[model samples]
Target: MSDQTSMISARGLRKSFVQRSRKGPGIEFEAVRGIDVDVRRGVAFGFLGPNGAGKSSTMRMICCVSPVSGGELRIFGLDPATHGPEIRSRIGVCPQEDTLDNELNVWENLYVYGRYFGLPRDVVRDRIDELLDFVQLTEKAQAKVDDLSGGMKRRLTIARSLINKPEILILDEPTTGLDPQARHVIWDRLFRLKQQGVTLVLTTHYMDEAEQLADRLVVMDKGVIVAEGSPRELIEQYSTREVAEIRFGVGENEALAPKVEDLAERVEVLPDRLLLYTDDGERALQDVLGRGLRPETTLVRRATLEDVFLRLTGRSLAD
Candidate 1:
């Protein structure tokens, strides 16, 4: 896409960390190798990867918290190296770790944070009320941070991030430790933000979260981008329509791989189960049964972004 239409753009972007060796000279650890990324305005974009996959490094550079080691990087069509303050003023960030002051009440936390951005007291107060209501934390506005539940704290953090009315919102693992219900709540709020024309850039390891929030995403592995596309597009390009999960007895799955390899288009042998990738998982399961192999359990499900990740990286997303 053209630069004029892209809110964030990168070409051959790279980040490295200098690590000192115990017995030798320092070594450079490449956290983000050469990669290109483009985030259009008013769209939710994601960086998906497992631990130590350069997702966080890329995000740091984007946020201007970490300097780029090499290559081109731009936010709002301006160079981060020179326009860090200008860019930061227009973006809001919800970090992975909760940084709220435990001694302060929820509303106070938001009010204080807004003050840091040089907002007027009346404006900050008004915005705090609106944000607390938006995140469904209106009832907890006067509650101390220590009294809030995990989900409530997360909601407060999201609300605080919006105090500035930023054009772009950057979330790092927004729902990392929340329960399913809590995660869905956060997702709904984020969906609303996107509908209101806020550009969202997030980093996540959860395949479902990426699929649910991102219109387009890039899958990163070992400091490099392995694939980039929408959830459905990546799944269609890298995996089959369906996946057949067959679980045998412990230690029995490995031996059965060869016998059932020809039944599906592709076979993935895990420690406890075998995944058969094919157009029709029910048909594949029938073929396996016809071959006289009785599995302990069988499940047929549609392909997911997790399946595409496995196909491209030959490793599970959780790994």
Candidate 2:
């Protein structure tokens, strides 16, 4: 892509950390291996991976808070090593943890963050009002930060990140530990941001979340990218169109796998379930039943990014 169209670009990017051993010299741990990434402007790009997959390390590097160990990284066509301040000024970051001051009220929290960006007093006040309204926190403007719910705190953090009207927003595990209702609310707000043409970079382990928001994504494992593509493309390339989830009695799924191996293109035996990957899940179910095998329950559903991750990594996305 052209430089004008790419928000962030990394070629052979690498990051390492020096760790001191208990009884020996310090050792180096390579957190992010050589990886290439191109984040286009005005698109929501995601990094999907399990914990310790180097997603956070990459995010730190992109935010210019952590120095690059090797290779090249350019944000908005500017090298972070020399232009860290300039790059950070135009980018907003919502880290994995909430960093709001609990002692401060909701409005104060946003107002203080705006001032930290060196915004004028009048401008900061105006922006705080707009952001509170945008995040649906107008009613809680005067409430202490500690009094808000998890969802409310998260919304406040998002609002704070936008005080500078950043060109790009980077979120790490945006909805890590929220309830279903709260998660959807955050998703709706993020969708609105995308519609407004803001470039978003997010890291998440939830396959459903990645499918909902990511225009394109890279799956990382063991500090390396294993696969990269749009959600539908990855699903089509790595998984069947439908998945047949069958559960026999306890400890019976493994024994039944051999009998129904021919029912689908692939069969994966789990502790409590057997997944049959096929184009026609209903036909596969019928075949299983035709063989005089009865399952306690059966569900035929459209394949998802979770299936793709499992197929590629031999592990569940949540793991």
Candidate 3:
């Protein structure tokens, strides 16, 4: 059963594809295993995972662009299988790639997309104006798509997605390939959208991006959800209150790891550094010093979402 208050609901949701080999029988590959998810309305929800973790497959199913192999998925309390068109009309999608038309000017691209929704010429024109202004692209309305910068093109694609004034907006890797300044600009725009009561659905590999944007998030791995919670809750649950990062030149981490094992609750040995997870990073560092171990450098900081990911999956988000 679907939750009416939720924008999206999935129960035992699964997706699979057939892989055919020239030398053998076709094999079935499961991209998404049985999983349950509920995205409440009027909140930003995020999906975080490493590559091939089935994030894209799940997003495609929610957008109704790909059919679910099994289980139930509902959008706005409507079955996507029978109400795909109705569901799509009420949602906007900003894909991973900026699929803008290079032949068209900024305004024309949005105009063409609005027309696809069967919106009236007058309404489309009015919508284009509002969207361009909202995305801070009004000044570039007549600029050729080929002449725009990467950030501009991304913002334009976001504007085009909003031509229908959708109630739900789905963004896939929204700020990838953008500079820090440009990424912050896009983040501001998304923040405004969420404040306006449009539910946001996002997938990102950037831990900081997930922390900043997602009110609630799920961490997926090997086609299944490993954990779910708000950023702070997840950090508190999976990580210590603080982390001490220590560096001791090259090829020294492995040897030093065991030496510092008793300093913190847990110790992780990386290629070039060591992470000590404990409630008091400063105390851990002092313990290390008292043991006559001299680290080249040390940093103590509060635990972040990245720490949570490392603790849960034993892999970096980029992996």
Candidate 4:
């Protein structure tokens, strides 16, 4: 089997939403500028960006929820514009916000969604029971959605999306409001899905989340892509193998920013701390100390996806 027959392929995708003017001149907003992406079967792909950077918009197009204005988007080699319903039938979607029915219980949510997809009653019933167990929500099957916790609701929503046993699963902001333990629960299940060779595409403003799940990813900024690669590759190419963050006691990070700009391969100074990027963090720290630069606090760590993100874009991912 050749690689060109990938599960998802997009080329030069462009999307702009028109804004109607009430008074003065209003203009159109191009949420997604021209971009291309591909995802093969049995791999997890991610879109990582700040808010309004077009991650969700791109996901919508892939799921056939929102149409693109120009360029190409194909799911399973089927054009989203011409084969939306057919494409949607093969994919499951979890929106950024919970869209679960407040009227339905946890199990009923999955059953009802399956039935809406025209699945046979027995099939829907069987899938619901299985999915409830898969999501670890068996105990809450009969509980009302309003009575469930935030993490429980998120899991239920995800379980609901899986009723059809779809070929592709698209998740937007999958763990937005969950605590650490809850997030781990969701991550564990997602990892199990990956082991089963489920093709997953997810959008997240969290850099750590992307690093955790994405086999390959694209980072978007200002409605355009800035970088695309596997987490380790992007970090190695765009940033250093290690980074040191130093916080000054008296002056702002900018006060010493210029002095240490050339100390590392790359430097970014914010209000709180200044980042020093270098292939060898220990050597960089020694040089800083040798230069008589004293910081109130210092932390040296391995270069991560967040470091690469901050280096490419001026803004933080969570911001």
Candidate 5:
């Protein structure tokens, strides 16, 4: 889509930082190399990569918290440099860390954040109740922030971010430390927000989370975007239909890799298992056994976003 139609647009966007070195003059470290991006209105766009892959830097620029070092960027058709305050007012940010004040209660946390947006007490109080209920934190509204569970704190943070009823919501590792159940609750809330026509932008380490939440995503590595597509498009482009996982005991995977290498389209020998990429995992396993090789255990599964990342980056997404 053209820049006019896109909610967020970038052309050769870049960000860099000056690093002070002990030996000599400070060096320049480019966190986000020049890249192009477009985030359409009301769609969930995700930035994904391993640690220090420019995802955070890009998000910072999008949120108008960090100035661009080079290239052009526009949020809501306004340059962040000139309209930083306006852009910030139109968007909500949920950072990776829980920034809630432990001294405040759950309701108080949202109350204070709304007031920061210059909202009137009556409006802020009303919005606080709506947000708390939206994030399923209404029952815990009177409880101390420090006493809330990790998931509750995360939900409260999300509620606080929405105090101004922003059109765009940016989340950084939204469910980093939450359990599966908690993560699902967070996902449900986010899904509802998206349904309400809020544009969702996020960065995540969990491949499954990306699959569930992102309509389109980009994979960045070493300060550049390496891949961009829907999760299924990415998997289809980078991986096979199925993956056959075979464990030949702890140290035997590498040694036995060659024996099954020709049985599938490709073979990846991890330290603990051999992943055979092929269209038919069952046939590949039978081929292994036909060769008189008996694996300690075997599992056949469909190719996923993680497999695509492994193929593109030569490592797990979390690594």
Candidate 6:
């Protein structure tokens, strides 16, 4: 069994799929380019990127569902290629999309899944009760899977993955479609799991979710990891401690962009305004106006992870 120390490790892990088009041409699709990752035990690690960023493919390789085409991969110190079943048996997985058995009631869903792992009926029953409470689904214990809301379905998926009491839990965009209340509830449960020393690995397109939950993470684009570190470390290294925003009063944002270019370590010009990243945002603000550049408004504030991603990738993460 893996202990509480780097349960997941990889070196140059890679996967590619070949696709043939209807136009009569075949091409190779590299879903996950060569990448390295290490997820330590008892902490939440996230893969942050927009859609089609290979986050899902990289996750599959770590979970051992998709065999890697190149390089090394180990979950719990066992090679995924050869120890697939053993590794899987010791890990919990909540996939990107819900795959519950619609025919099963909430309780039966848990019971049936537990039986798949060969758990004794009595053990399954006891664990089912506990899990229902963990996810706050006890009140709807007998509801059919088809009858649950989007949030309830997600919570049930999380509960089902834990039935085996796996050493590691992997969640791929687990709360994508939930309401804000439901999302908060899920976040609270995840925080409790982390506090209890459960190792978690998750992928998400939501920057706020990544910032709120991840202890350490990797930011990916295209098919490779562009940056990796704790959330705060990344912001400090790639961006300034603070930023000054200046909106154009009449002229274009670029008209004032050159004025603040060297006032900060970096300056990014957008359609409506310009951003100056520096240690002292006030100083940068004074410098911009002192240069005779006129603007509608100026706002100074602390740096955020969103700024770091934008500077590194040359575009907003969502767009």
Prediction-by-prediction clash tally: 0, 0, 0, 0, 0, 0
Better-scoring candidate (TM-score), 1 or 6: 1
lDDT tens per residue, model 6, 4-109 = 5778888987889879888977899998888899988887999998888899998898788898988888898999889998998889999999989999899998
lDDT of 3 by residue, 191-259 (tens): 999888889999988889999999999998888999999999999999999999999989988987989
lDDT at 304, model 5 = 92
Q: Candidate 1 overall Cα lDDT vs. reference?
A: 0.93
Ranking by lDDT: 2, 1, 3, 5, 6, 4
After superposition, the stretches of candidate 1 with alpha carbons farther than 4 Å from their true spots are 1-4, 21-23
What would the per-residue lDDT of candidate 1 be over residues 201-294, giving only the tens digit for each residue? 9999999999999999999999999999999999999999999999999999999999999999999988889999999999999999999999
**Predicted structure 3, TM vs. truth:** 0.96
Query: Candidate 2 vs candidate 3: which has greater lDDT?
Result: 2
> Per-residue alpha-carbon lDDT of model 5 for 86-196, expressed as tens digits?
988889999999899999999988888888888899999999879888988888989999999999999998999899989889999999999999999999999999888
Tens-digit lDDT track of model 2 for 1-319: 1124889999999999999889989999999998899998888999999998999999999999999999999999999999998999899999899999999999999998999889899999999999999999999999999999999999999999999999899999999999999999999999999988899999999999999999999999888999999999999999999999999999999998999999999998888899999999999999999999999999999999889888988988777
What TM-score number comes out for model 2?
Answer: 0.97
lDDT of 2: 0.94
User: Each candidate: what lDDT?
Assistant: 0.93, 0.94, 0.91, 0.88, 0.91, 0.88
Report the Cα lDDT for candidate 6: 0.88
Stretch of 10 with least lDDT, candidate 6: 1-10
* TM-scores for candidates 1 onward, in order: 0.97, 0.97, 0.96, 0.96, 0.96, 0.90
Per-residue error for 233 in candidate 2, Å, reads: 0.6
Error of 5 at 15 (Å): 1.3
Tens digits of per-residue lDDT for model 4, 204-279: 8888899999999999987899999999999988888999888897566788888888889888887789999988
Least well predicted 10-residue stretch by lDDT in candidate 4 = 1-10
lDDT score, candidate 1, position 305: 90
**How far off is residue 261 in model 4, in Å?**
2.9
